[model samples]
Target: MTSVDITEARKTDAPATPVIEAKDLTRHFKVGRGFSRQMLHAVDDVNFSIGHQEIVALAGESGSGKSTIARLLAGVYKPTGGEIFYQGRAMSTFKSRKDQLAYRGDVPMVFQDPFSSLNPAFRVSHGILRSLKLHRPEFSRPQREEEAARVIETVGLTPAGDIMHRYPYELSGGQRQRIGFAQALAHKPKLILADEPVSMLDVSIRIGLLNLMAELRRSEGVSFLYITHDIASARYVADRLMIMYAGHIVESGPAESVLANPKHPYTDLLLGAVPDPRAPLAEGIEGDTGEPPKVIDPTPGCRFRWRCPLAIDRCHVETPLPRRLGENHEAACHVAEPDPGFRE
Candidate 1:
């Protein structure tokens, strides 16, 4: 077994404290009519941590529970089970109004759709100013306005004065998304849960938004939980990557290492789906085609068994515990094996 050195993978002297941590974090929704209620496990037994100034990308296909995890972290949805911790403090303990306010100020979210996330009736500056007023009440009215303009410029919206006054419908999709980033920045948050912030923007503008995020991480020491389905974009921006399938985090580790050598079959399948210029048309991983398993009233066992080619009897009867592949890499698979071509 090839072991990866965690310290080397970090490549930076980040602080020891974790910005956010999820311990057995699970969120299940009750679905169906009164007599036929069933549980939909959106996020199940997920465990991971993001350190200060780190960018952890949560990658999966649609309905893989990536957005649900983001909502849980952002405190939009209360967990059906498990706990979330921020800076070593349990989120459940923040029951007091004051504590909840403080937590929200420190942790802000950027939603997927810029058009819908922002208020259509209000000007762009109104959204940014509102966040600043809520999070930074100490700032005077003039200071708040100045800070709002600064953040707009910070997010790559040039001529902040002109852009700030426009309504959501007035700006282009890319510009509106930049406004979303500006709103998140207005709070000076310790952590940002960006749920597909760039998925809706134009291809020409995707790189610009990604570069802005990278700049924030470098300049401001902001930690991010970037949720997306694009593995290629995740690799381009994140330091660490977590792969989810059927509400389970099947693989996670340093981004470079995991992408170069995936242990789990699901991870391999996701990577194979990424568009490659060199590969011939219709050339990709075969036989793994089907709708994802239904989450409602899910049966016990590996959820990926229906699509996994390597699944065996044990896989159908038992749930595999996460096996340590290296110092920081882990995969939940009964038949996981090292790739011979993989190298550190």
Candidate 2:
């Protein structure tokens, strides 16, 4: 649907408390052959929350562990260490069949590649119908078909009659993505883990999908954890922004505040890279030339030390704890001075 229609669908209600919380979550993988096995710290001591109907963007470059965190939240991978709570209940305790089934219904995911998630052997409607039957078995055949069509229309694929019959290979990338959204919506989920949902689509189609997600949050009260590498898109769609580097969250806060006055050197480097017509081409952060540290058996100190322009002796010896920079704003940097503009 159009942006105007999506905005008009918003609800007027007070914000709700967090529906998902990750406390000191860590996930490590073993790399290399059996004799030379080494730990690859994919997600290290990361913590964050997603409130009801909120959209939190996780932004970082490739290999920064953004996708790893998303997988952990979606319950695709049990964290090697730490815990995940859904609506205040521990996810690890969901060992019973009934509990696992309930949790799956409550949390659905939209993958990065729409083609990979769909079945080429069946029509698009069959996938949505299958999800409906699995999640809402009470519905009869007619009800299931009606619900599927309604959701497909909700994602802005007009005249569901025409689109439902098309196979995955018959549709374009954008059409397949809309079907992905339809499939996720079929579950009537409380939250969605969107792993780079727009990174694979044409640039022109990205904004429309983002708008549809915002519409879902507004009208259906569905929360979203948007994982992406593009800082500009994150700023546009997120209520909160978390910046990750080498598996650690170095900075996080409300989107506008963090983007306006970035406290971490890595965050500044990322923001500077975004093309801005107002700024001259010469304006950019220097000393960001070195390669990111290998995640295998990483050092104890700050992971960004080798490339930070403001690195000091202490940064190489001790890891910096997350320090408060402003209201709801925190950064992990030994030398990041609190901006006077944010002082009480």
Candidate 3:
């Protein structure tokens, strides 16, 4: 198991219990039947953690398996390799339906599309009420209504009474997304797995959602595993940043440290891919247009060699192990030089 070397202490100097921890966690899909059965590597040996009240951004392009990791942590998809520890408890020990439900309640998922996540036929209150019934069974229907209203207001939607009566269609994209969060809050979760929650919203509206996440961490002490391809938004909300490529966590560190000095070629590539509003307009976006590799029965080497500028011969034959770049900074690259005074 690859240790999450970059993990931070949630309280004192000592390491606090991570809300979610993955130890060489992996997941693969069966693509074909019997004779032609092929494994499509969705998430491969992913190791990371979300400290108490910490926001860890899992940034990657499509097919990078960011969403799969979210589902794995949420107990929706069973892992094919390794184990997941929630607040230091091994998920493998959870064998019964009651245990599974408890885990789901503790870690609720907020998906990308707000409209699709909620039922159009039902009013907005349906999901929150149902979540309360399933998870917080102690709450009566009246108490659920009051708690639901509080959560709606918590997400910055005022007059919860008015919003609760409306259907998913009546709300704006941003409002619908906040409603998704409200439903998750009904579970009284310790952690939230938000998968591209703002990518579909307008640029101005995106910032508001990002700010809401930051506030959630500050006010509620809730941790978040924010998965998205947008590096800029990731930097804004995440305390720690992890870059994924071809189903592997290629880099991880403090958000500022990783963004300013990306150790992996893939991390650098992702940052370079972000737009600079200050720069003049261009006919076409510059940089390598290479797509991330499709890993189906993948070879035993770096999956990013096809597009990496710093790929050496070592990257072709042997898979590169993550080497320390600095304190709380590591990058999986064979030829990447240490920044200044790194030991390994």
Candidate maximizing lDDT: 2
Query: Each model's number of backbone clashes?
Result: 0, 0, 0
Q: Name the runs in model 2 displaced over 4 angstroms.
A: 1-16, 277-285, 341-344
Off by over 4 Å in 3: 1-15, 278-292
The number of clashing residue pairs in model 1 is: 0
| Residue-wise C-alpha lDDT for candidate 1, range 1-94, written one tens digit per residue | 0013222333365568799999999999988988998889898899999999888999999999999998888888998889999999999999
Query: What TM-score quantifies how close candidate 2 is to the native fold?
Result: 0.93
Each candidate structure's TM-score, on Cα atoms with residue i matched to residue i, is 0.93, 0.93, 0.93
Q: What ranking emerges by TM-score with the best candidate at the front?
A: 2, 1, 3
lDDT of 1: 0.86
Higher-TM-score candidate among 2 and 3? 2
Model 2 poorest ten-residue lDDT run: 5-14
